[model samples]
Target: MTRSATARTRILNCTLTLSIILHAPLALAKTPVATGTGGAVATISEQASRSALAILDKGGNAIDAAVAAAATLGVTDPFSCGIGGGGFMVIYLAKDKRVITIDHRETAPAAFTPATFLENGKEIDFDTAVASGAAVGVPGTVRGWHEALERYGTMNFKQVLAPAIDVANQGFTVTDIFSRLTRENERKFQQFGTTSALYLRDGKALPAGTMLRNPGMAKAYREIAARGQRAFYTGPMARAIVDAVNRPPVAGGAGVRAGKMTLADLANYEARIRQPVASTYRGYALYGMPLPSSGGVTVAEALNILEGYDLKAMPRADAEHLYLEASRLAFADRNAYLADPEYVDAPVAGLLSKAFAAQRRTAIDPKRAAASVAAGDPYAYQEDQSIPLRPQARPLQKENAHTTHFTVSDKDGNVVSYTFTIESWGGSGIVVPGYGFLLNNEMTDFDFSGPRPNVPEAGKRPRSSMAPTIALKDGKPAFTIGSPGGSTIITTVLQTIVNHVDFGMPMDAAINAPRLSERNGAATSVEPGFAGSAQARALEAFGHTWEATPEEIGAANALVFNPDGTVTAVSEGRRHGVGSALVQRKGH
Candidate 1:
């Protein structure tokens, strides 16, 4: 048989196996427990959740399920993430009682320099910058998957990737949101022939319910499945990726010059496994992704400040005010000190110190907001003396990054919270000729105009707000939660944790509660539910200006472990996510 015929037959057989594995009932299923019971998966896509659950039902561990779910998301929710992106994963291995953080963040190519984004000493247009090869970073997602599967997963790389490969080969029904996003970025997609050919049809975006098949992406997946990470990072796939990125744009296309990426950059890439940053909030131990990600330090700093207040005793409005204030102070530090540790000396030890939070807390006025908040001297708190601080740069405009997050807990008590992104929707607008996947525009994540801590540097990963977090109580896993919304991600995660720990809300309620964000010096942005309510007025009374935005805070997904050892899973309903629990009742 021809190669195409063989692949088709294999996909058909896999589909049949998946149908039975996902839908058929087990003969000896465990007894049903309450909501917080059994293995569960929650994510932005329903199909992704089902894929994870199916893996768990087949005896795969949390790491296995997470990989399966993430892979599926790449195919089903291509705009958010794919093999072309990078991310962080926080995993709790129940057997070892250890927390591991994997930083698979994309990095600048070896050819990058401070002036890469500048021409004639002026920053290039944002649109032109993003639609070019210069914006593409050395992808780390494919390598990350292989690393996680080989080290911590119970299953092999091919096993975890099969579900996504099947989906890519057989095609899936597109959702309304997918169709809308495609239409919105139609002109951008049309700028690159490969992208236009893959995502658009007849010079237009595909409509909802279109059975989208990505055979090229399927082929890419198959290569990885057979040859492992080397397939993408060192072999034919790497060459295709480099060629696509380094190719000059066609005439009339909206893009900048080709980048300076090299094969060595791809071959030398490695996903670092680092220790998670840990802090205590109201007796619960919180763990967040460390440097290269500002989420953990920022969230921990805010939680430390909130710890000083008796939030449970305050009225709802006062509670909201305190939360917002704490978030503001935390963000101040984030803007000043957070960057890739390899490139900048991020004072991680001082940033999360409770003493530093205590010192910074003094800046907050219970009844009114500060005229302008500044980054605190965390080193002073650590050394018991003031140290010289750098002049703070103006905060960059909020990034409209598109990302995906998912949480999975297996029956063995292992859990994984993962967040991945391609930097923006339809990243770089340049697809590898035969790969059918978008390349991450992660280079734009840097401070482009001037020399700052996060300026483009060769081999340095961009600073990210993608924090995949886990909370522990009494040295045991309590909750796994995370979200996707650029800088709003830090505040979104802060609110969810507060809702659950202080307000005594269930996992679902905490995830779905109204959200607010105050990053840098911008006006506080509140969701419609809180915009015109008494809470907004109360915040206004505290000298806080506010703006109303549609309820597009963050897509937070969480898995909560109850005191009784039950597990509750919830996905932010606002973003059309779904939650599934792999529980077996007596009848089944």
Candidate 2:
């Protein structure tokens, strides 16, 4: 052959090889970016979404927009989450290829102990620990946002917080979720006069779209604006927390020993920065919040295991085979091993490994189903022993905790995935009057009668299912996604990523589409809207009990950046006016 002809043949071979790599199906999914300019913003509340867009328009980058949106969310969506609580933040910085995980999770009060919730040999009424003065933890949301802004943001604290302050001071309409949740907890709110006055309007829970202004919250923000994060952590705000929790007025102003929090707990609190739990599927990288939050590891592992299956050809709502098989592996690991990484040595690396996933995937039979599945002994694989966790007895009755989520991206290529919760709606239904929000009943996150580590411990963080996630393709961020659900946060987030990345759905479709999740042998919870008649029938045929509500699991949001330089963003439809936004440079 002529030298030129031979060279031409080699070039063609290289081209084919690259094409195969690019087009080949990956183990994990990648989102199809809908916008060509590659910028998008998403959040659970419309007010928050619009706030983020305003910041982006004002020349703030992704970090600024995210912080602004988060602060706005705290105001507009008070029943679900806020600065009064705590949360986790995951950031993808393109310039340095850095994936930062910030753990601003709430901490147990210093004076707390296992015995605090123990009466005789049995646990106290779970409600005793879950409600009232004792449930509140050391809030870290304020500090967490401040940390992110200091490190990556262009705007100062006041600038970033003004939007939220305005909304809280001037009022935004009460959302449907807020109204429903508030009414449900009206009696609890009325238990404390201060709490009632703040959340209730004319002795009734505020109606949806009622213009609700929280001057107290605005005052709190004012303090934050003037004194920075310290206002909330160590200064007057801290004093307010100390006075309120220790001398809570609910039971004639009883103090701690009577089951209340103290000053020391507030003063000593500090937020953490932890290593992200990372896993790869099909060349795309997934990163999420680490322990004290098992959501990240569980979601990462679930995706890793699913990658071993060929899901595209499976029947829609492939309940007997695909859903159950993938769920069996994921939830088993979640139950047997997942926990607060700070206290336990979880073998996350081994759990998500290709070899480990392959071994587990074999349990699935394409034609039938495994009657039951168990957590295969990790000992079978010789997983690293450096990680140590004392396993807890799984819960007998599923407790409920509600969470909130948001995702943001800027033209500068910074991404943020954040999830926060008050454990349940209008947490404890007990508000600290001047604080402008209800406190979280996060103590419920602990198993009432689990092993030593899983029980409530003084100064320890609770286990959480707040899974905030960011996915990267070819070393660039493809999207940021997260959701608000108690146990289902993991599955809702996992499937959304799969829909976008693996099945090639747009961001809106990925988040709004029907989804399903199973936890620790429970009946699978499929989104009422997402389940098809076929899927529902298949589930019933398999003797699975199913509930079909608009969305039984969660409310999710996602932002996908397309290769063609556009962005597509979506929020859960049931979330009620979940908003979408994009900000591009005028001439770009």
Candidate 3:
């Protein structure tokens, strides 16, 4: 069958049924309260949410509260994001109507060789390359957060870190989500003494509401507060990391080689600042991740193409079909032309253009899915950009279960959308000693081939699917949102934008609404809970396939502003998170 027909059948039959099973009805997502405003924050953790509120109550700006809350989250919600990982920060300064993207992404070790992962001219399995030190990238989250605080925040690092110190020193109730993930990965933790000691209590993961403490993490926070990034990257913390990483693992084990990452790699790493990939569709300006991340450009292209249709008028299933087809076209382009701008040429400017979007949209069939769409030659459109195309052998599909994210907005109109991950649970099962966390297995995200040919090239950033985005209407900030779910991140953010901008749903409604995803022209997966029988059946008629799970959509945190000046915040129920609004009391 053609890719389009297959997608139509799969969506109508298989994927549709699965979505209904996963998504709870929309009514379940409603909150009792209506629109409210003042200063509010939504994140993936409760204690951290409370901490942000405390900062607001204490006269700290949103940036201050965000930094404080972020520190607290690192200690309390270690399963998702922490100091050990690196991510981007999108800051919106309402005063100047400016949005800045701080790209503190992790880079490969200097000693990394392009052909390091190849075995006898064949590419290595994704997991094998990732579990090795070859996967470790220089972490930049701490410095990135600190930079935001220093530049725009009112509170000091010490003050903001206090909340985290309290949580780590005294401990907080272990929530259900925390306990569940820990238990699921207990065996990996058990294999590493330090890992087991930190997360597992008496050979079992901490139960919900169990008081858990992390004095080590707190101490590490203190060092950062006092000495800044240097303390963590090269000081005692560095020594501790080297010591832990250098420890040889048990024979026939997954422990990475000791000292595979040298101090030089840590010292040479530098976070970058690049322009946010941007495009306009139906008058709304869309901004997303740039080169080194396939998310921003690909999402822009998808949105641009979808703009041609009146999604609101179409049935949810038909709209979904259109989205899947457009996503497939975008992903095909992503697999072909998207790469690190620093290492490889990327036709970003050409790809996000209106003309390019129109051309790509022509390949889409509103009635059926296009099973296969070849990537267009970006050079054909942009003369200045060109890269020789080389096809690499396809590797096995490896499912990765690791990702975390949070969004923060200060009263001053400073906003940050941060996403990070360990690539998998307990990343490589190697603890960085005193750092109290596992290193990311991001290397697995790359296609390991040969020396410089789709290989593990040192300093080359991997393609990330993380899509933390901010939307603007006529050049004004309208919404800020992001999610965790690997490939699912892109679809979730796109839907939230549509839910708010196109459907006029409230912040909570948009975030809590059902989500679906299509990667590289493959099957479209919907959160079973969101689709009804009619929509599901329609999708099958369109030839899209589905995989049912407990929830079709992953967690998303968001903030939105209406024309009336009311601000609303939201977080999904599926996550161990809370969304709070501190709107001025009515008639106050």
Clashing pairs in 1: 36-566, 36-567, 37-567
Cα lDDT computed for each candidate against the true fold: 0.75, 0.65, 0.64
The digit string of per-residue lDDT tens for model 1 on 1-588 reads 111211111110000000001222233322111143455555666567667766777777878888888888888877778888788888888899989989998999999998888888777766677678998899999888888888988888778788888888989988787888788778778888888888889768899989999998888988888888999999889998998889933335554568888999999999999999889999988889898988899999999999999989988778878888899888888888788988787777888888888888888878877654778877765643344556474553455446777766766777788888887777777878888888878887777755567788899898888778889999888887888777777888899899989989887788777788877555776666676677677778888886533445667777777776666666655544333333321111
Per-residue lDDT of 166 in model 1: 84
Clashes of 2: 19
Instruction: Point to the candidate with the largest lDDT.
Output: 1
Candidate 2 lDDT, tens digit per residue, 1-588?
111211111110000000000011112112212232533555555566556666666677777877787777778777777776888888877687888888888888877776666668676654455456777777778888888888887887788778888888888887676787778767666666677777787668888878888888888888888888888878677877766666555634422223456666776777777878888877788898888887887787777678866666565555234655576577777667766666666666777667777787777665554444676445345456644543543422244546777777766677788787667666655677677766776765665555644567778787777788888888887777787777677777787777776677776777666666666444565654545566566665555554333345676777666676656565555544434433332113
Query: Candidate 2 has what TM-score?
Result: 0.87
Once superposed on the true structure, which residue ranges of model 1 sit more than 4 Å away at CA?
A: 1-36, 248-255, 383-389, 548-551, 577-588
| Ten residues in sequence with the least summed lDDT for candidate 1 | 11-20
If both were scored by lDDT, which would come out higher, candidate 2 or candidate 3? 2
Ranking by TM-score: 1, 3, 2
